[model samples]
Target: MPGYGAPQNNGYGNYGNTGQGNGYGASQPYGYPSPAQPAITVGDGLSWAWSRITDNPVVLLVGFGLWTVLTGIGVEASYTVNGVEHSYGLGIPGGNIISLAAILIGPIALAHVGILTSSGRKASFRDVFTFPNFLQAFLAILLSRLAILIGTIFLIIPGIILGYLFSFVAYAAVERNLGVTAAMRYSMRLLSDNVGLLLPFALIGFLLYVAGAITVIGWIITGPLVALMTTYAYVRVQGRDVARYPSQG
Candidate 1:
């Protein structure tokens, strides 16, 4: 595996294979890159993610569908409150607690598939269930939201900024197996230099989701696309290379 002073290898250059396993296993250097690391634009990340989806359309659909069903079961189970028809589940300030299962598990599912896709391997249904560092991931999600909530208390803008800053916590925790604080800190530093690009990337992804939600069937595509785009960005920003295009079998 490549490290700090390692020479570039195909774009994964300085950073090597995340680890040896089905998922992005263990610590594979989520540290700072050389000062001159190339900046991956939002377009680059989206395009790479799109190519990956296009290449594995059927499998992605199956995988994401499976994920939806698995997570949806938990979400739906808590919908009824005192026999009332609560379609949206237990509500909170932003979203509902029932929906939190999806929010928490979505990224981990994507990270598993994305890591395989980026590694030039075929994505599979099992990837959705193959959670790496799930406990750390769960803790990171809760802690990051708590921090964001605190920031939100201060003012809306600070909350949004913290949201953007800590956006990659799940990736760091699951992919690198970092602890809660370490994962939060890693995510902050990862994007500290890329805020200008992060805002627009996030906005476009949100718009895609909203548009997809309106169409209903569109979520089948846009949902994974946006998640994979984030995965691409996270890998690239770490000074690693992603399979920009799909590999031929």
Candidate 2:
């Protein structure tokens, strides 16, 4: 996501259509903090990411590990062509399946942090996996990701726009007890208000993610970074307030 940058500076605008970015999100906030904004270092991003991975390593790992495993499973099925069968369909690999599962698990993650952040960022996964709410957590992960996916495709540029726009949709779902649509819109709103910060956040996230994904150890290590960032984004953007998930119990 961060690999691209200000169409003009990074030459991504022409990259999208010519390469795509399309001056796409400029109509939104289109404003970043003044040049006075300090750079968000690679280490800071990694630290935040690392803290999350370490904080709730178990559920986070279970949630994302399932996703990673499912991710590796591939999303194809077989079909018939003329008389002989061809090779391909659409089933979402273990990676996507796990990610999809995260939507459902989102509220759980929120509950994990909601009380903790409210109590002053002391959340852990201990209470996040109480069983009854697990399904809700799974749904939140699946639907939210899918909704955002749909929104992103609304227009190619818009899709990229939503890709960045709804960056924090999962967190909103839990913090606000929001359904998929509401949370997605909220994320879009947050990005519309803060698109500039997103690119940099993404750039850092991407670097960490790529580095982690470069190897099995990297993938295992970095997978949680993505989750942590997404979770942190949700908490920070939603603010530290006790929001109820839709009664997952």
Candidate 3:
């Protein structure tokens, strides 16, 4: 079990301590290119993601299961009426709220699981409830979504650009403990520097998302795969090293 930038064993048995100090910080001043960062390929990202999944199947599956249930309950179906598109949640009246919450909480929980398992600690499904920088992450994600939506209203291209630019905002907030503006800035720098390498990976992730949508069970695999892949890309793009599994050896 190899953790990212954090120590392998930090002595905290429970999920109380949020994993931090991964070379991502406000002090570093983002939005600049790192000249020495190596190029990462789409194959490398997918391979790393698959390796992590195989190595930590139980934790990943458990987390993904929780995410799926919450996400499904809060799932929204959209339809067009008189050239206007509208959506509603499938669950109860406030199901949309639950769905929005799921989007924010699910991935961070999975990242916590990643931190635990990678640090050689056994992770519990309850780790999904542990959120670090909750307010910051929530605001960053909300604002980014709103901005992307506004861009989309103007034209689809700006939305896609904004999507790519702020793709790693959640990871930045969760892993780096960045504030709302800092997280967006960090993500923008990462994307701007690695667009050549990251574009293909994003395209593949989109395909996986579509594939996952076709079947309920498909999400069990693709959901975590995409999450892990994005996490891997985040680390690599930042010029940090990822732990290679035994099979990758």
Global lDDT of each model?
0.67, 0.47, 0.68
TM-scores for every predicted model: 0.71, 0.53, 0.75
Tens digit of lDDT per residue, candidate 3, span 75-110? 768999999999866657777777778876666666
lDDT of 2 by residue, 1-249 (tens): 232222222211211121222221111112322233223344444565565545556655665555555455544557887899887534554546564444455445544443233222333355444322233334545665565577767756655654576566544544344554655666677767765655666666677678875675666766666656654444334322111111111
Pairs in steric clash, model 1 = 8-13, 9-13
User: What's the lDDT for residue 122 in model 2?
Assistant: 32
User: How many times do residue backbones clash in model 2?
Assistant: 25
Candidate 2 vs. true structure, TM-score: 0.53
Q: Which candidate wins on TM-score?
A: 3
Separate clash counts for every candidate: 2, 25, 0
- Sort all candidates by TM-score, best to worst: 3, 1, 2
* lDDT tens per residue, model 1, 1-249: 122122112222222344333233212233333244346787777878788888888888777865554444443333667888556433344334445667676766677667667756667776667767778778888888888999999888889888888888877766666677877887888788777767677888889889876886787888788888787777776666665434433
Which candidate ranks first by lDDT, i.e. highest? 3
In model 1, which regions exceed 4 Å deviation? 1-39, 66-98, 245-249
